[model samples]
Target: MSDKPKIKVLVVDDEQDIVDLLKYNLEKEGYEVATANDGIKAVKVAAKFIPDVILLDIMMPHQDGVETCRQIREIPETKKAFVIFLTARSEEYSEVAAFDVGADDYITKPIKPRALMSRISALFRRESKKEQENVQVRIKDLIIDKTSYTIDKNGKILTLPKKEFELLYFLAKNPNMVFSRDELLQNIWGADVFVLARTVDVHIRKVREKIGEDYITTVKGVGYKFD
Candidate 1:
């Protein structure tokens, strides 16, 4: 066995067969697995297990996946865990809402196990690469510390959610370089991530709201750049 610690994964769905299948296959791949049958239970299980990734179903009894994700984000213990929405719904609006509430990725149902496993592996590899590059980027008065996932603006620390912080960091990293929404989505959200380009707009609006207007400039009909 490799010396690296096993990845913890929590599979959440109301469908028992689906949950069982995911747990079995994930365990087969050497991931430490856990399962929850509904959204409410998912929150409790996630808080306790603190899994590195959560595969959440959108529709569930008592509470829905969006609500469950919101609750999980609020809980400090599980807030940073990567959330991937596993839904049958393929609507663009649903994807937007998922990203709005801190979802890291979205996947449509009837997914092949092999494809899902590949995506999961990619997520971990991306995270490992991020960990290795802990360079602190200072852009104007805003300081982005990739190591701590913190942003300091004008001597005061700004409280930003994971996605918002990531958006800011990506733009600030390449200061003055323009990034189209598609490019931002690919770079920040990862190439395998399923999200609409509008998701970048939503995150940009939120980031500008917190960080002030002057830092990020919108290039007409193109995209945005860190000013």
Candidate 2:
């Protein structure tokens, strides 16, 4: 925490081009980057490098992003790694799966370098801010520890990422306080941020999945809350 330490990044994908392009661009931005070609090796590299963040691709030869994320979650060393899913899947169901597996963010393929840089910058900014942030919140049965960045439901630890954890924290902090998507976007994602409402739904759905279905009540015409 003394200075901006080397930002180690591990990118996993089957496509050599994506890995090369990301490494080139991320290195251009001065981040220390590493690459892995599949889900299995991704775990190994992640343990070795303990990367500051991970850019994970969903489809690969042996294992896919979902299974890889599951494996990564199992390893305590990579448990807190900030992961972003880089893939070509744009379906709502696919996005929901990505969130369920602890993706900090989802960026589709055919990436624009400028927009990629912008989004990466946002993540870096958020990471910098999180350096001083505490990660603890207690709900009825859902307990969140921001310091360790772990969530516990009924005393069981639930894996979550920066954004999803923050979203849950915001909702838990104000239990029973209904928040519209606009309000949530402002409160959780910043007031000026722009993301599809489906993003919020995906996150909420994931939270519900981690804890239990029906743990979060949907407000039909409004937003969400912890039930």
Best by lDDT: 1
Alpha-carbon lDDT, every model? 0.88, 0.78
Sum up the clashes in candidate 2: 3
Which regions of candidate 2 are displaced past 4 Å? 1-3, 130-135, 138-143, 151-164, 185-217
The deviation in Å at residue 129 for candidate 2 is: 3.8
TM-score of 2: 0.78
In the predicted model 2, the residue pairs found to clash are 135-145, 135-146, 136-146
For model 1, what is the error of residue 69's alpha carbon versus the real structure, in angstroms, after optimal superposition? Answer: 1.4
**60-177, model 1: which lDDT tens digit per residue?**
9989898899889888777778998999998888888888989998889986789899888888788788777756888799889876677888889976777888889888888899
Candidate 1: stretches off by over 4 Å: none
